[model samples]
Target: MDTSTMIFIAVGLIAVIAGLYIYFYNKDKKTLPEAPAAPGSQELAHSKQLRLQAYERLVILAERIALPNLISRSNEPGLDKRSMQQLLTQTIRQEFDYNLSQQIYVSNEAWEAIRNLKEQNIHIINQIASILPEDISGVELNKKVIEFIMNQPQGSMHTMVQEALSYEARKLMA
Candidate 1:
């Protein structure tokens, strides 16, 4: 080749070699292997703190939902059928409403199941009331309510309550 031709070929060879080096050097980057996570840093610690706050909120929610406030607000020693039904249903709704803030931290499954369980418990209380004689004593009525709760279907209420507790626990973990 002539002198100019030789210089041109040299430049072309240099460009090709540089391109190859860059291509091979960066090939691994296209499929980066996930590096194992190291120990927690400041940011990680902050994230953990946030998670702990979420857990606390969830626990509060669970408590509010499940607490009885010593005795039900609508307690009536001689509640008639309509009054009793309203009281039982209102108690269920009040419990759920009081825990309304907890939905943010808990899973959809947990919240939905808990809501369903509360409804079912109210329904069960109503069912028990339906079979009672008009002359049933207050003591007997209270016993019947307790018995209905004891015989709730397949530990359904227990499962929902447990799930709520689990959600609170999971929130605390990073």
Candidate 2:
């Protein structure tokens, strides 16, 4: 072939290659995935509602486990100190277990505070029970439990747990 014709053919091949490369590059850029959408307002509202309900339930649980309320609700005539202690402890455990699922909706700090309150209440009951004689009446045990609660620096665990729940609820509202 003539030199001019051969040079012309070479230039044509290079042009075609460049054209193909540009075409594929633009195609690939166009095909790139988009970023996901943010959560909708309905979903956000639902999550907030669930969290508020959890805080409310936790507040109620804390109140139910309070020493005075628990003693009044569970106290029975003719019961000994040991039986009364067991009853109170069992009631606290049951209340805690029922509300265990609420922890997922609440902040870690709030959940931890609730758990600590439960432990403190149980501790106070056991401590008072241990000091009293086996034959001590339920009425006497109830009185001692109230006296111990009265002496606590913060009044009671119930107040602390309730406050924590309230704080979290307020945060959600804000």
Candidate 3:
């Protein structure tokens, strides 16, 4: 098989592993028997709420960074393709940075998925921008990005990440 196909399979395997990790992590927690309310039960409840909120924010983050949503929200008429690429990448980085603390409340697998999605989007923007003529407008860059995503089978990795976040969050609720 081609290297790209191999790479795609590898990535798919990793995602499946992450999903199973979250599932078993939650399952182990769920199997624990409930005890009489202790003095620390309030603290545990508060901690779960914090984790839930972090997952909610991460889901929002995934939606915000998804290429189609980002392109529509960030469209500017007068800039060049390179500038657009910079803007897109910078916005993603900033969003990820702002939520860095949320990582502590989430599983390592979930955080890695979020980080991977951010990096992938940035890489896609840079790769597309690099191939276009230097004179193309930002609007054209945005169009090219949308077109590129539409053609790629794995372009909507953000959707997968969001679903994982939601599933984990629901597990926390349970």
Model 1 scores worst on lDDT over the 10 consecutive residues at: 62-71
Q: What does candidate 2's lDDT look like per residue over 1-174, in tens digits?
A: 234643443454344334434543554365435335466777777888999999999999989988899999998988888888889999999999999999999877677767866876787677667767888898898998786556544345567557657865885786
For each candidate in turn, the TM-score is 0.52, 0.75, 0.79
Best by lDDT: 3
Give the C-alpha miss distance for residue 156 in model 2, angstroms: 2.1
What do the candidate models score in CA lDDT, each in turn?
A: 0.52, 0.74, 0.80
- Give me the runs in candidate 1 sitting further than 4 Å from their true place: 1-75, 135-139, 151-156
lDDT of 3: 0.80
Best first by TM-score, ranked: 3, 2, 1
Q: Give the TM-score of candidate 1.
A: 0.52
Q: What is the lDDT of residue 114 in candidate 3?
A: 92
lDDT of 1: 0.52
Candidates sorted on lDDT, descending:
3, 2, 1
What's the CA RMSD of model 3 in angstroms? 4.8
**Shift in Å, residue 9, candidate 3:** 14
TM-score of 3: 0.79
| Candidate 2 Cα deviation (angstroms), residue 13 | 87
lDDT of 2 at 61: 91
Which candidate model has the greater lDDT, 1 or 2? 2
